[model samples]
Target: MSKAADNIRFVIIMAATLFVMSLGALRLMKLQLVDGSSYLQKSLSSNTAEQVINAPRGEIADSSGEYLVSNKAGFNAVIQKAFFPTDNREINRIILKVANVLEEENVSWEDALPISENAPFEFLPDRESDIARLRKNIGVQVYGTAEECIIAMTGLYETDPQLTDREKRIIAGVRYTMYLRDFSVSNRYTFAEDITMEAVVRLKELTYELDGVDIVQEAVREVKTGDVIPHLIGTVGAISAEEYDQLKGSGYALNDTLGKGGIEKAMESTLRGKKGVRTLEIQGGAVVNDEITEEAVPGNTIKLTVDSDYQRKVQTILENHIYWLNNQTSSKAKGTEANAGALVVLDARSGALLAGATAPTYDLKDYLENYSKVANGENSPLLNRVTSGLYRPGSTFKTVTATAALNEGIISPTDVVNCQKYYTYWEGWSPECTGYHGRLNVVGALRESCNIFFYEVGRVMGIDRITEYASKYGLGEEMGLETGRGVKTGYIASPDTFEARQQVWQAGNVIQAAIGQSDTYVTPLQMADQALMIGNRGVRYQTYMVDSVYTYNMEELVSKTEPTVAAVIEDKTGHTFDKVIEGMEEAAAFKAYTYPTVKEYYTDSYLLTELPKKAAIKTGTPQMTSKSDTGSAFIGFYPADDPDIAFSGFVEKGEYSKLMIRELIEAYYNKDYHIEKLGGRTEEELAAALSDNEDTDSFDEDNEDLED
Candidate 1:
């Protein structure tokens, strides 16, 4: 009976084994016959090679549709992973042939390899880090020699068949560059950018032998404004390795271009478009199918608040004035040279920077070619004096003092103060004025920029009050231009600031501070904002040069940065800015008929009858350090009754006649001398057609410096 039970168990075990084997056979047959096409498709899809498609950078424009900076179609030579040879010796031979073809066609190819191609191989100093990174990638030590490093690279990349000395050198160089560029199987390499058409055609023809070589069409930054607004518009350059490393996660390629300075740098993220990707299914190095996995999003267009025409007019006028100031023999003054100057015009209500110009400037196109010349030249052209250049506000501060004094009840609008030409409130510390006006009210004091009147008022209000008003008007604060060195806020004379800078602020410092002298310094931009604030009756707007941002097609609105209030005067009544503006109106009243509110200002009256708009002005000739040389400053607003435009102009060492604040005002309202207000250009437009191309003949060019 035990033997019979054993036989039955064996039979059952055999039946179970047969059932399991049958199930395995059925599953194998299903995979091979029924689902075969799906598996095949999956297998082919896995062989795809990914490529990056760079998006065109955004075009920059003035508020109008005119473009200041744009992009043009550019040709570049690139390497394709699909066609690239796998053999090390073949790759070296192909790359050398590629280099030879480029050289023959007079086309430049960018090879960032650290080691020299010639014998006695040398490492480039500028590529030290790149070389070290490549070495570490190839298992080389930091102490290894350049040739040893090259030899080490050959073992990994140019292996299998032995490479000749020349072949080894060539392959090693390309390999090192590939490593530095963070090249991968998916990301091919960019050999050259902005190549000529002849080079492109030649490269395409040689693609069979060169293998992987392609001519890709791309966009290159083209400055539409030429040299006009070069400093403000800024420049774009090839991405550094450090930059690439920082942006790699964000899909940035090594050959990408980026803004290096000015507005370009400030608005990079807004201007740079999103990158796209292309995937190709390759079978035995042959691409059988291709697809766009992602679509590139074009960059948003940026519209600047600058009126190209008005800005050019102001720039030309300022330039011509400085040129005259430098050569004027009779008015040959001392102090800081007048080789540099700045002028800014803004919408009083909006704080829109309609125009801002800096002298000793260069065209945007010429920047690359003339970089060394401009950089090494005197009175730096790169320096945006509108915000970065600091100088004493001079007598312009009288308005601030007047505002504070009247607001704090230290002085009444009709109060009288004696300008005995000098004030001696402290013993052995008498501050003298340029003129000896006997007696003057608040209006007369501002009309003449009376130092004594402000000195006495400042004494009553104290330094703290003056500082409070200055801060309220956005003085000694960042202008928020974000245009690199063009937006730095200047220093204000204060006890805290003086202490921080390791200097002393004494009782007499308050007197000089009130007169826009002492340790106080203000930029032309700040002064312009001050003018706008005064014209707007204490409402200081957050000044901006850019107006709006749109898509490339102008069909979609990306962003619109409208004018917003930055600060406002605490005075609820018309006691502060209104009274100070009345004084300003008087200062601009060079003629009796135009603006009869204030007394006659001892300056030229050309703008009174000549321009379309009347102005309220204040003049300053502060001997920055000495009595002989003075910096010319003028703060004014147009149509004194209903202010439209506000202006601030400064010359390092200027005469009163060269201020030309009147001409700038007239140029804005009238189209006759409207140089900077013209529309910008298109992407395809040539540099010769740039706007702001006008003459300086219409305005009165005959004037010498005002006597201090």
Candidate 2:
């Protein structure tokens, strides 16, 4: 009631009003000047959306213009934030519906979340490796268990607090992935890829209930010969976080698919089509303005030198023989069971790979599902033996030693070496020979596979010269398979290699080395190349698989393969190659003549009795541990005078007598059997010698320690 009290209240009210006004003006300044762009973007995002249009990947065809790998139109489920329901409960329900449909169809969907779905949840044991990286990338904090991590993320997704832990975990995982992918109005998240038609139909039928869910038609890789050529063709998979980080500048999205191996990875730039963009104006969960900002460009086509027909037949031959050998009841078939094998056929003149076959094959459809099993299998079906396998040259390497000697003038075709059944050098440590081939020349030495002659000649020529000739023949060199890093170039057996393996090369090493049983190991591809060179009488051509590249319709040629000479075999004794050819001719001819008479005597007999063009072949069986057999190999070319096709084939843990490689050649040529035309019957005599004095150590050339 006093005048002093009224005046004090008035002053307090006026000061308080001024303070509140100052606070409002300061907040307005901060919004307008400091954070204007951030607010503007948020406002724009609510009314805008984008739909990505993926371009079609390239097609791959074989030499005869048949499809090896192509593309088929498929559907992927996606989520668009602009059309998505604002409620977390609605989003969770929609995802569950799609997941249920996919589960019912027995189809796979992308679920990279590390957590297990079971009660008392833990991280997937196999997925543990990816956890540290994923957590770091997504900016998630460390947790003791997967359940703890999920609970932490559930709060981030703002899912219903009353929901069960399982549902919360599922919703949190998908949201976490979307966040990692930077999913927004412009970049939609891929929920599931390569969905089946049944699943797609079910999704579309329930579209009325599924507000934000979308079915996008996508182009997925379609393998034609899925069973025959998985390693050669390879597969495409989602880009990893690391790959995305490295490739983001090159316009790759977080969910982009990339070739993981083989030709696909080799030519990714050519095969990956140009991505297109679609801009849209959305309001109230509806697309208002929509247009394609950039038109998509389909990927270019790749043409290979492979003949799928020949590849298929070759695969069948290997499969059948391996199956038969493994199950054989005959006594002679012992140690002939092939665990793994490789066959490579080359166009001798052009060096184009016609067929490259590796056994213990798998279907491409099962590649992703069975990847772990195949990778961990004892036989290693995933390994491409054409490039990855290394085996001793066995007798197949004799031609190389012969070339080196003749080139260096170390031995003459007529110069005879009296085989005394054993070769003794300085140490009295003699490498025994299977037979005493007396007074044999180079050609006859090759026919009889006389070890003493080669031992003498190779030692006389020295290791350096032999290595030089082998290098010139591309025995230990890359032939360009488009791996970017090239393929495995097998090592030559020598003192230098011996040193690398932490061992000193003694004088005893040379005797076995000379007989193709030494440390010299070669790949099947190299052997095929060597055969091509010898069959062509010393012209080595570069081998390649891809023939050409073109536009999607295969109308415009992008690039083409031109036959290039890799090397030439020059010998000091110019005409000595003819004598060497005579040796191989006699060897094959001898096998042809004695095949029938020795059919019961030996497990494997020459299947090439009649030839469209007479073949010159050299068989090699490498010796390994006393109990375990080494690889069996044969290299040759057809039409002794002029070879068009050069081939090399081998079987791991197999005996040379049972490979039946001759059958493959006969089938390739489609020739009927005729005994009279076979020029030499000497192999029958040799067949008896082979069976009577069977030396496990002499079954093949001795296998030296090889590194690739």
Candidate 3:
């Protein structure tokens, strides 16, 4: 009985075992037949990466729709962190090989390391910040020398000793740059940008050996009219660590290009389009599937109020006049030291900047290629003199004083003041005038730029009244501009300005201030805005450069900048500005006989006689200090009876600021001088044309004579 029971149990166990084996066989068959491809894909796949597809930055155009800045297709050599070699030695080897290839092709790569490439290592003199960052990055002390830092970096990167010092330095530079960019599985590094197709093809040939390397096609910022408006249409550069830290939360990548100054920086958000995502599936070191997960939206186009061709013409005129001034041999020609200046034109009614020209300027493309030479060049070519340079308003401030005196009831149109060529108002202070006119009214005073007349008037109006009027005219106030920040708000000659400088404000200062001489400084833009206000009869519009913004393809209008009234000076007396306008007009129309020696240089005492339309103008010679030469300044508006445009110009150590007026007015009136429509051509065609014209210097012929 026991043997029979044991046999039954054994049979049951055998049956259960067979049933389990049959279930396993069925499961294996299902997996092989139904899910085989999916499993096989999972086994062979190396990575599934989500890459950022950079969007094209916006194009910038003038009000007439001429391209000022645009984008051209270019290639960049980049390295994906996920696919880059993991081993340190292998990484160094790949970098060394890539560097050699670039060197052989005479192409440059990004190398921010401050150390010298050769064995006699030394820290770059101008890269103080970079050296400090490098020292901090390598766990070296601030006191560590360049040699010590290089040795430490060599060991830190685990570079092979068999490599030459130069080879190691090259690899170190790339490694350090990658580290600074925070190279990780989530971020890629840009090795070099704006590379040639030949280099791209060469790189592609070594794709299998160059792990993680890629050639990305992108839109490079091209300055179509770089020479026309470089200061306003700014520059674009690689994203710095500081910029990245501030922008990372706003979808900015570790590797990104950003605006450095001017319009580019001001409209960064508007110009930086949303980046798209591309999901890449890699298998056996090759992409098996590629899909664009998100489509990129290109940046909007910014249209400025400036006319590019008019601006170019203005620049040429300014350059030519400056050159002529510096080359004059006559003793009567006094501005031999004239080396730099600025001129600004604005629509008198709207305050729209028509043109702004800064002398000693440089082309944007040349500035990028030869940064050191241009940056360190004489006369400060990079300085935006129109907005940043501060100079005493000189006699130009007399207009403000005259306005204050007239508006405050201190003076009248026919009120006469005797001029003995000296104002002995205070006990110890006596300011001299250019000539002794026996008796003159407000019109005669302005026409002659009579200092004694204004001094007496200013003494009666007082400093407080002068300051008030100056503020109303936008002097010592911020002129709202669409271009980027760093505009200077120069102060009026007042007790407050003296106090800020920790100097005592004497009672006699008001007389000097009345003539625009005491501690008063103003920008060319401010001067232009003031002229606009005067032209508009006390109404001041907010000065602006951008007219509107449009969609990437320029099919849709995003926003328009209207002519907004910023401030208004009400004439309580109804005809308060009548006499002031009369004075400016008289000044513009004044004529004086000249000696033969200087007649050719100064055709008329007032230089606006040849202008097609009547102009209300004022000229000033500001003496900054006892040691510095006087600077020439002029402010005016055309068609005195019906003002249209206002202009202000300043020339450092220059004589006649009015010399450029007639030519500028002619350029503006002649519609044929406007830049041709660049919208008809595609971006590629425009870029090609610009490239072909790169060697065509805009001011070369005009400046050749002034090169001494």
Candidate 4:
């Protein structure tokens, strides 16, 4: 065909093709208009949705209305994974600066970054040609401290598969394929989350000047008063895979905060707040409707039974005494330095625990910042001593023995029992005492702490009779305290003691058992609770720390724990037991249980000075198999005629019973204080008290002497 004719034919063909294409497009549009909703619903179901999780802040408070923790908006600089520095040298420098800044701000960068500057990218596939050039122009001209730079570089290297054996192993696993694919797909991951609030705020306000740094809000624990209540209030941490599986149906997500310690763990059910849900409707790549289906319900506010004033006083006393003892004790065997103990005070009438204190405690603030140090430190300071420490009751168990003696008719209050011999025999078993008392009654036996007297009584009564009596007095049983765990009901040798004697138990063992030794163990709380029962007339009540729990909106969800009576024996069962009580008063008053040669110190001269009122106490030093070990114990009630509160203290392997009791006496009974006088001191007097040059020094020489 000619050129003109061919061009005309081409135009005709193009017109025909255009018309057909238009007709098909119009027909598809018609179909879409008629049935678009069904198709659109089907298409929407396959699309990915962004899950916006609203995390509520955790609440923390002291026993009083003081807030120990509250949320403060924090700024975080999040860098998209796609924008991560590719060059080893450039990444190293960036990390080095970050570390230096963190240290300057008193923040730890170790967990966030652990790679080194000089470390090679061994994990990357071999196509990294631009890294060397990229390292030369990292933009920032400021140089960081060499130490911090090295730390940051090392931190980064250690985290990546290139430098760590473990990471390399993880990279080799097919199970990690999903993680790797997701990481690439999102092109997003966290670089650091612990930037301080101050730094975050500055960054947020000045984002225009900062490149590749975007601020995002992230959740962090608010520790108001530091680590004051770590062992009690507890903490939160990431959920474990096992926990996720167990809580699958309970709506706990993979990264949900889980209670890992203290009351948080104990009352997780009541404390865990509900999480909310959000849904979004997207059309043509634009979100049309965003709906909040549920709102987050924060964890309950727990009100503990602890009286802050008393708790604080006990803590102060303990720390002061421990400090004093540490200073006095010799380096060879410092009793106070190893003074890992607990002090518990409870209402005698009601089982409310007024104070529960433990020594060598970590600051909750330090724990949140340096959790590993608190969790696995050299002192193991995280362990709760009140509910966890169990020791032999020593002579404190005599109260149980005396009750058994009364109930079993082994002895009468008026009937005097001969305790002249150092040894007494019962059922072919004999137990020795510290010394022989010429003549003793049931009252005198307790006054002198006569082991031979109890041995004689036990022989007449037998093992079955001993445990039976002990059970009534609340021994060999859990004290029913709400500590969640570790409050053990110590062993009480059973009727099988005789049978075990045929095999494992011995006559000496029976003798020791009679005097509160052998396999018997009791917690400080149990020991104190039993003493209160005696003072309160046979009423045994359960103990609790939590008073109530409330929601964030101030709605009370649970009431304070009411005192539950665990046991109440007949009052007449041990009514005549007053004779033993009288003897106990003499023992504490005259130090009658001490050696006779120390009479002047044990008489009215010493007794009137320490406890002027009518007070009853018993001190015990149980012999240990290891000659060097001695278990010291003391139980006392002030104004013995009308007791309101009672206390029991035990020191593992204590050197002297007198020293321990002296401190115990001063803790509760010593009423004299110079606080008002000291408070009234003039500035001139305070200044005059300071040394000539000592006041100018910032560092305390005392701190230099502490054990690292």
Candidate 5:
């Protein structure tokens, strides 16, 4: 070939080769400079697998370091919606298995397998006979295939008349659940009520044996003494829609649990540990590579100010009194409802709430599963009456007025006053006493709960003095206790009530105020605090349920409860609390000033005289303003002179305060015999009250006290 042609062909080939080399070099430079680290990380991720690690939950203890609530491990039967079957027969079989297991274990099926009008499916027990029986009745054969079970577990109940559409969807999505695990047992031999470690192991074994089945360790709560402290400890539930919307991206997931009531609600932030995230690479909705994007910091440990023995005593007292109250008030006022009472015991010196009890309270284990039943029941069993209930203080409030009168120099201890049957001031208003006890001193008035004596003293002191004294006595305010539940600050008459009463604040209104009427509503906690103040000679302490918060590492976030003087009656205040206390002591003994004719009632009939331990006791009966009966209440402390603990108890719609006082006294003195004494009443007397006649315009003088 010609030299020119050969040169042209060679030039074309070399030019093409050089151009390719230049392009390759530029591509190498871009990769090295622009995305080198990104590719390297991707490569490393493909080789190295990440895992999620869960932090240990914190422990819980009571005042004496006894276990009241705690955490444990258990198995959860979770069905990922993706893997679950949509068939009804499979669902029935699975439910039968669950139900059988629960029944065989002797766990109460009231909650776990509840028959709900709004739920399409029912939970199953793990027993062959039960499953076969259910299958026969439903005409659904149980092959026990994993696919069949998954289909039934995830089935949509289109035909089930009881279930709502939303409920069906929710049930379908919530395919898996961990068991309610507890460590404490009734006795060492028998299995504990809660899900056991053995069950968890069995679940793991089941997962290994079955394909498309898996198990994960999930935290479960174990209320160490749940039955004893149901009202005080409370339970947790899923966050509401509003809570979810507000907490979105605030680190709370849609499935996060929120505090529903009691200590759980009160100390939510401290008890609910900081949640962490586990990001997994999922294939067909199944996790393959699990990586803990964030670490979970377990919740802080909460130490309560509760005493187990004291709590038991309060329960015993309440149960015993239920019978006598029903008998005495059934005909007169229709008596209290079946589940209508609450009691609280507090350490008068430290504001440490020792025992809190509420009647007709549903078990915490059953509460979540049967929420509707609890909420819509005739009696609100889930209500924490001790902290949330508000009522007229009745005679217990007289302590406040007495303290005020003594401070105001309105009346001296030795000053004698005559009490007529009743007092009449203006038109259409007559404040009457139950009986006339002539020539009685302040101490005597307190013992008999005399309305006239306090009326006179209150008239001298007036409303301003009453309010001031009430404040000093820790009324009309929130007692900062650890329960975090919303406690009513308690309503006191504003300036307007007094300003409106300026012309009328003289004898009658003041008299009404002296009796705990005239715009006064208080919580049981307040009553207990006042009693404690009197028990401790007017030294008020900051009440706290939680002694401290600690980390898993045992680092204390909060210190132990410190005793604080809430208020003190100073010399300049013109009050000597000792005088009021002296009256209270005599009244507690039921022997303040006995008139010749007023001694018909035997001394043995009085509760204070028969108490095992000396207690300064007071009873109160407030007029009700609703369908509920007048509230009955009692406040006292053991070893009255120098007391270690003080308590106050109230029963809603209770007709007579004396009966409750007797029950409390008897329970303290004769522990085993108290219930028997109260149980003498028949079933007819125990029926719930019918109606309450209340007039807000008129005042009931029986409820007032000078102790505020």
Candidate 6:
């Protein structure tokens, strides 16, 4: 009975086993023949990624084809999300280790978290937007304190509780940066840029511990002629969150760098070349094959109108004259507070800026390293005074007065105006002149700079006619420069400007405005443009800084700037500007013969009894206040009979603006002046100099009480 049951059980068990085996074989055959290829394609696609290969940024050069800014190969530390650990604690550990390595090698990494590094954490000043972003990302209230946000970030990122506040802060910063960059398989986060080889080597040693970290080679901005024109060339830095949001649709990655200021920013579209793509195949958390699917295109090269050598000479002249003025002990020298100034030279016929120099300037590298110190330094070294500085034109405004008087037939060029040493035109306002010239015509008045003559003429023409002439000559107007923003459109001293300040425009204000006082303020660039218009007699041209743009290798031209007419002065009397030109010529002759200060400063070899070419020049000593020293200003055009170049200079609280005239003329006529070159001040030197220059005499351009 047991044998029969065992036999029956064996037969049933064999039959069941055979049926299960047949079903398993059929399923394996279907999977192997039909679904295998689909699953294999899915596995391959999941591991493959497309990476952006950034193109090299364009280079910048002066008009003479000398490189001002270029690019060099550098290494960057990157973190790939596909290979990173998913655990929060592991991510924190890896970031802290990488930060330690960077600190040891004296390398800087991107840590833009708004909280302070120490325990008594406070939000940094002027980082409202960043702080707001941090708060939102961490799910904190908008009004939450820095400490509260830090605590929230610490908890959210699962930072190590045993770590110090500083270590926790480091971890939080990297994690937040990752979040801001949208770090994922498609987008890699850049941990550090332009790192030293030492840092790269150290980071590589910890490759096993730092799972996601990798080294990448990229092109970094290399400043070649930073000292000559730092303010104009500007700088490049990491793209901000706001910038990323605006540029993301344009195929810009969060890790991309862009121009931060000046020409670099103005020409960003041309300088930032198109990006390329690289397709990578990953297997076992390692990149197995990488192929370039698209090739990167380098940016265009920009050619500026400025000649580097001439620019350097101009910078030296301004710096030297400013230095001399600051050290003067004579009572006649009122430049003890003259710590800053600007000088500009332009081609009178074309309005091409040949040279522009702003003193109390800084190096670009120093600015990139310690932006706060440079930005907030004494005298505002970051300020491009040539285009941004607003100063009283003083006697320089008389040019507009004479033009108005003659054009409107209020007074002829031969008509005489009495000078009583004071303009008693109004009862309470009696603005005095430098001396009592008794009576003088237009040419004589300009030669002697008689405030009384201009005051009488300005009162006759009224403020409307005066403003019309001033606008024609580009006074108190925009220069229409091709450079970046910050070009101020200063206003003329009229009822409109006074009304803008919510003040009454008194009748006597016209007398002051006639002499370049009251509310009239202008930049040195505008002054040069005025001189250029005077040289051209009636026509004014739009000024430009960029000359042309070319391909990356400069083999093909992209674009070129052409001279364009901006304005033409309308004259009822065709001989209006004739008298103004004669007056300026006589004024230059008067200075050459009577002014001994310029002759005393130059050696006999450099000095001359007469200029190489006749110049039409005028000087101004605009008073800031009764207590404050006056500002020195001068404008001129060379070869008065056949004007070639026009120039202007202004020194704060200086009384010797004429001293620069002779030297500038010499530089323009001779090529030797551009031979000598000098390097810019170092960061340490700049800091020490700024500290020593404490009496900056800050002047608020918008202050209502600032009267000349």
Q: Evaluate all candidate structures by whole-model CA lDDT and list the values in order.
A: 0.74, 0.74, 0.81, 0.56, 0.60, 0.81
Candidate 3 TM-score, C-alpha based: 0.87
lDDT for each residue of candidate 6 in 1-708, tens digit (9 for 90 to 100) = 699999999999999999999999989888878887876675565377988878899899999999989888899899987789999999998999999999999998887888777888999998999988888878999899988988898899888789998998889888888887778777789998889999988898889889989998988788877787788788988789999889889888777789888888889999999888888888755678889999999999999988887887888888877765565433333466788899999988899999989988988878878888999899999999999888888888888888888887899878998887887867886877766678899999998888888888888889998888888888877788866488777888999999999989988888889988899988999999998888888888889988999999688999999998989887669888788988888877662232222222333323222776678887788876653667889898888877888999999877667667777777877757643222255656534432332222332222211111
lDDT of 4 at 333: 29
lDDT of candidate 2 over 140-228, digit per residue (tens): 67655666667667665667778777667667667767766777778888888878899999999999999878998878777776875
Candidate 5 has a TM-score of 0.67
lDDT of 3 by residue, 1-708 (tens): 699999999999999999999999988988898887778877786878787888899999998898889989889889987678889999998888878888888789988788887878999888887788889989999989888987897899899888888988898899998887777655678898888778888999999999989898888778877787788888888788778889999988767788899999999999998888888887776667789999999999999999877887888777756665665544444577889999999998899999999988999988878888999989999999999999998888888998888787888778999999778766676777776676998888887888889889988889999999999999989899977487889898787789889999988888888888889989999999988888888999989999999999688999998898988998866666777777788877764433222333323422576676678988888886753578889888887877888999999887777767776777788956543333345767545432321122232332211100
Off by over 4 Å in 3: 1-48, 282-288, 595-607, 672-708
Question: Candidate 6 has which clashing residue pairs, if any?
Answer: none
Tens-place lDDT per residue, model 4, 1-708, is 799999999999999999999999988887698677767876665333444343554465555755555455554545433344556444444444443454556654212111222334232233232222122222212343323333333443443424443333222221122122232212333334568766666556644543334567755556666535457777766555456679768877553557777766677776677766555565654445657776666666667766554565565544443443333322222243336556666677677676666666778888877766777775457776666666777777777787777755677776666766557354564554555565888777777777777776766677666777667666767776665665667667653644655547654565567767777766777777776776666677777677666676346565556778878755565565576567667777553222221121122223422655666666676544453466556665555666656666655444333333433444444434211222234667534432133121333332221110
- Best of the two (1, 4) by lDDT: 1
Which of 3 and 5 is the better model by TM-score? 3
Model 3 Cα shift for residue 523 (angstroms): 0.4
lDDT of 4: 0.56
The C-alpha stretches of model 5 lying farther than 4 A from their native spots are 1-56, 77-213, 245-250, 274-297, 327-339, 425-428, 494-508, 550-558, 571-575, 591-607, 610-614, 626-629, 655-708
Query: Per-candidate TM vs. native?
Result: 0.79, 0.83, 0.87, 0.69, 0.67, 0.87
